[model samples]
Target: MKKLIFFLLLLLAGFNLMAQQDGGTYRAQLPEITMDSTSSLHIISPEPIRYVDISSHAVAGDLPEENVLRLKWVPDSTGNLSSGADNLGVVTVIGQTFIAQYQLLSAAATPGSKLAASYDILPQHIRPLHLPVEISTPQLRSHALSLLARRNPSAIRTAKQYGISAELNHVYTLGDLILLDITYHNSTNLGYDIDELRFKIEDKKITKATNVQSVEIRPIWQLYPIGSFKRSYRNIYVLKKATFPASKILSVELSEKQISGRTIILKIKYRDILEADNF
Candidate 1:
């Protein structure tokens, strides 16, 4: 049941792309980003980047993947927004030179400053899953206990959708990743299992002025066993942090893993991101 999801959605290079949506004039707080192959976006500005709004277009550009490159915010490894994670950074995927435009609401860049981004393609390939020999079962249980004990929930941020309730536990931004802590609860009799789950986002609007095509966010993490009560786990283990378009109505859709038709939508407000960042 868990294996088929990788092939569920056709990774059509640039399918369902919205026409060039006007992102309006965006200011580059940091004049130049050291665009490299790695998925991290390096900005010189120290300001919080949650306010940065960006949209990517699938154009017939000079790159191999005309629709190959996509941008996402790199979430902290621990899913805690503040710990060793970046709330204000952008990361690109598929290592291609595509067109991405963004803007900051409160900051302005020096005149003639061009916003630049690049991805140096690495040896990207899907390898067989391997578990190291040094780890013991006792160690695994100890680690799980540590994750279960995480107690950071920003009292101000909380949301419930698809029978799942999430409270913003903790978030810290760093130079590399943004740490995030979230406690999830399933109110129904059905069990929560990633082997059969799916996550997607529809960009109804980016900020008050921008728009983007809908995208499927893949491979979420599960901390405890299925049907655990009020259990919280930072999804940093299996999921990479992502940058979402600063959309006004960011719809996070979750569907039953085994039964795709049974789904739920969480309308994440713009305030959700900002408030989490502020916390």
Candidate 2:
């Protein structure tokens, strides 16, 4: 009977050891960062951070820009910082287009490595598994402007009203985003004070007067600021990936401020989106 009990205990011990080894495989392999009780470490990210996961033993928070995280080690009951992997904690920082994991240890507890005040999360350190997030807003605008600079071989779509012309020069697709190169020309001498640039999916033919339904879609990013422009104005706008049937059309509406008398609307068909070029 005693032998049977000892065998059962040995089997449970082996199972626990195997579980610990399996779990350790998924831990961060990078060398642990040292944090001392005297100063904090500033970790900068490439883009705006969306989430941060840190250990309870350390206190961490984002700055005003939300792209930098300041982390500091907490002192234990003995008035000393924690040391080693078991005593310290792990930090996982997630941004729009990047992710990094760090193991933090106390400088006072570990004497080998030097104390660094700040760390930059570079592109090479980004985790490969989580690459589906969207790029920064500035990058999207820059890409759109680059497309605008090039000449377009595709047919141009335009809408003209009150000596103001709105043209759709090109459409490009990236992942789940749609980039559009649009231009406006003011033939009249007066400057056009822009009020609002609206995008909507509406019916091609508004037959019923009582039930006119349209879905307003805002751009995820705009290349230019919304204000007055003289002569000619060229810019880019980005919207989320969407689909509409033949019965509906994507409308780009530009209206003048205050008076609201001068307005131009450009219609984009579903086929145009389907035949968009990949950037």
Candidate 3:
């Protein structure tokens, strides 16, 4: 009888140990959020939620601190806490326990005029993953601009000495579809083929206006002495019709290639149209 009793006690202890090892607990603490406000509710979990099994749902009963897992207010039909037309509330959980805080936008002076909020607790199992890499033009453009702006004049002179010349110019908009004349001079020894040139306009008030090409001209060079090789190249870029704001940034990039050392020049002119404001 003594042996049997001792065996039964040992079995009970083993069962209790197994039960404790198989179960886990959690608690959640949430902050408050108001309507029309950029606020975030913080959720704190006692134990890392990542350890929980993905197939199982973590409920309030599974939490170690069940008393703290109460909703701050009765939720409305849309699962939101509202005093009238405003939504101000949040729910957060730490481990297996959760706490919800509702923001009081208006006075709940009248009886039964309190905000109601409700939500279903969801089981979350997050997995770590890597994202694929992709190129972004805007990021590249910003980096390139920063690099160009910080370049020293010595670098520009070296490029000029290598028969490469770069120029920065702008087009000012006058009244009605009229543009002022623009000019670019290349003091390099090598001629470059204009690969591509782009223009960005900075204006906020201007409306849609068609880009018109007016004139493009290049100067010719008669073969003379080694020091007297004056050559010029020019063209007018006709832009598509487009509307623009009063404040904007116009960017133009030109590319070129040449065999013989020569300087290149460019001239551009255009017209912009605006709608007649009839107040």
Better of 1 and 2 by TM-score: 2
TM-score, per-candidate, Cα-based: 0.32, 0.62, 0.21
Best-to-worst order by lDDT is 2, 1, 3
Q: Give stretches of model 2 more than 4 Å off.
A: 1-43, 56-60, 63-91, 102-119, 131-146, 153-155, 187-195, 207-210, 222-228, 256-262
Q: Against the true structure, candidate 3 has what lDDT?
A: 0.32
Q: Give lDDT tens digits, candidate 2, residues 75-176.
A: 442264445434457788887766688776655554434667889987766774455657675488568768977986644688999999988889899889
Off by over 4 Å in 1: 1-148, 152-163, 193-201, 204-212, 217-245, 248-251, 259-261, 267-279
Per-residue lDDT tens digits for candidate 1, residues 1-279, read 555654454433224333244434333432223222223333321111212233322111222222233343332322333322123343222211122332311111222233344433323211122332233233434444454576654443566766777554544332222334445567766666543233445665456565556666553333344333333323422233456656534444434456534454545544554444411
Ranking by TM-score: 2, 1, 3
On a 0 to 100 scale, what is the lDDT of residue 77 in model 2? 26
Superposed Cα deviation of residue 44, candidate 1 (Å): 40
Which candidate wins on lDDT?
A: 2
lDDT measured at residue 275 in model 3 versus the true structure, 0 to 100: 28
Estimate, for each residue in 94-184, the C-alpha lDDT of model 3 and write its tens digit: 3323222323232223233232232233333321223221212233334333433443333111123234443422222222222212223
Angstrom error at residue 134, model 3: 43
